[model samples]
Target: MKEEKMRFPLSPKANPQAVITGEHYRFTVLTPKLIRLEYAENGMFEDRATQTVLNRAFPVPAFRKLENDVSLEIITEAFHLHYLKKGPFSPNALFIEVKSNFTNYKNRGRRLADLANEF
Candidate 1:
């Protein structure tokens, strides 16, 4: 059987999560091992770095009326990402929810969601 080699967003060694579809943004895992990445749908970027997350919505899709962008949620130690669609109060909008680490970040007093939000 052929082993499937996954493609990292950037230099799997440096910024594996540095993927981009046009001007959209990507997330980078600062953690050591288990480094993976994913891309955020256009129009969604939540800057949770400081305090609030900013949603970048634009274009409105013209026909489908998509007025929101996607956001990248990175779960630390889980080695994965969730692609959240653009929408308000969308339970399914949660892009990616990866548990790279079987154990949550509670041990570190932080959370993977917060890390991805900052990215």
Candidate 2:
């Protein structure tokens, strides 16, 4: 098979101010309510937009990150995030608490734990 020229090439959005990275984990704050979490077993994270992610050039949202020896915390206007800096993601390892006037939403890492294993 012959190779064809690509119509649309991928463009990278590298916003260092919006990212928090560790040895094997990377968390990017895309918006006040949207965050991108990535894990690389080989310690290499993707920088360019992929087929699933077309546009990643979002304005950096307001957030504060706190880190301890055992855990990491990120606070934003819309939510609070807690992550255990252990091996991989677990129900007890990561959680998000949504801040709202109406209701409180607590999300455990059931699906996030699976994503870690795929790496």
Candidate 3:
């Protein structure tokens, strides 16, 4: 089978004042199918483990800022990503939700505990 990928390059948009201030959140829309979320301390580097978990080779998505500084959204033909900034001292304050138009009947409505119990 062939691997599917995004058709366009990723675009990143964030509040000009947003930074790694040990409380700020960074959102990068890597592709229509993938996004990278990063949090840093004291305006420094992001955690290596976090980077590892979110890293993937995919085309980037287009980004757009919301009406307010604390929120933004990214979208493609199949997926939509929304992000919200929480606070400064809370580098992990970034909240994200990804919605996809596609559906998988087999995995639908599976709870976290149910998946954990499977193993």
Candidate 4:
């Protein structure tokens, strides 16, 4: 049998603020932090020093700065993306899940407890 890997649709419009929605929440190999937070006096997208923060914070974001002079352009603000490889898993089965609250990830322990014996 031939092997085929699946790809998920990662859109920049989905979460303009990088809110970590739907598919992005299950990001094992990929997650979102903040790339460029600071702004210039005229509200221009300047100084990409966030790379340093990203190094320390693990996964950070990249912004789509306007294609004009930062001083003149208002830079309405947006986001960018880059493929990240986190870990190595066996290419045997393909399983994908959609979630909202990323904070509840830790409680995945009692998934199959079967506490009460229904005799």
Candidate 5:
């Protein structure tokens, strides 16, 4: 049997409601299954890094607009993502919340070992 490889396009159309563009970064909702986050040091045309985070692995996500367009809710099969835009107090903060059926437990043994492996 041949193993199929999944491919995600680097550029995709942004959802008008959830899209935000800044001088150094561009954030957009590409599709119900994925969201694209891009950053450029100089500008979008130079020295850029792009990454697409999966929102729904199987079923498509449902997007919900929150109060006064301050927050957005992305409901997926695997997880729920809550995105909060920067506010008056936090002018440069981007907050994200991931709700899933998993607990994040820090491994003390792996902490030092992982740091050493980096070198």
Candidate 6:
């Protein structure tokens, strides 16, 4: 009896205050209306916690990251994100505004890079 080869377990862990990266995009808030968008062209990003995400110790909601030098805004507690730190993901770069029923919801615009699998 000698035949063993089984190794498949990964939990990279990503909660650096609810992650938010760039250079290909990678955002993860996981709460306050859930948020987790990732697009890696070659930046390599996969913080595990898949398989329907059993748990990730969330509870760091209360965001606000307004950057300069192009654009990059993120005000959570129910979304208001806009990015374009260098451009590539079009629809005017990006958008996500949904701060709890805006008088009949009408700010729709979220094309999160899937333009026929953008090259």
Clashes of each: 15, 0, 6, 0, 0, 0
lDDT of 6 by residue, 9-118 (tens): 55446578888887888778877777777777887987666777656667778888887766677887787878775655556667778788658656644453442234
| Candidate with better TM-score, 1 vs 3 | 3
Q: Choose 2 or 4, whichever is better by TM-score.
A: 2
Of the pair 2 and 3, which is ahead by lDDT? 2
Write the number of the candidate with greater lDDT, choosing between 1 and 2: 2
Q: List the global CA lDDT of all models.
A: 0.35, 0.76, 0.42, 0.25, 0.41, 0.71
**Residues 57-95, candidate 1, lDDT per residue (tens digit)?**
211111111122444444444433444433332334333
lDDT, candidate 5, 23-74, per-residue tens: 4555455455455555556545321333533232223235553333344344
**In terms of lDDT, which candidate is strongest?**
2
- Give a tens-digit lDDT track for model 3, residues 77-98: 5454444444442223232334
Q: If both were scored by lDDT, which would come out higher, candidate 4 or candidate 5?
A: 5
Candidate 3 versus the native: TM-score? 0.40
The best-first sequence of candidates by TM-score reads 2, 3, 5, 6, 1, 4
Instruction: Tell how far residue 29 is off in model 4, in angstroms.
Output: 19
Model 1: lDDT equals 0.35
Worst ten in a row by lDDT for model 2: 110-119
For candidate 2, write residues 1-119 as lDDT tens digits. 99998776555574789999999788988888888888778879878776766677767789999998667888999988887777665556777878874645435536544534543
Which regions of candidate 2 deviate over 4 angstroms?
1-10, 101-119
Worst 10 residues of 6 by lDDT: 110-119
In candidate 6, stretches whose alpha carbon ends up further than 4 angstroms from where it belongs are 1-15, 26-59, 62-77, 80-87, 109-119
Q: Between the candidate structures 1 and 6, which one is better when assessed by lDDT?
A: 6
Candidate 4 residue runs with Cα over 4 Å from true position = 17-32, 36-119
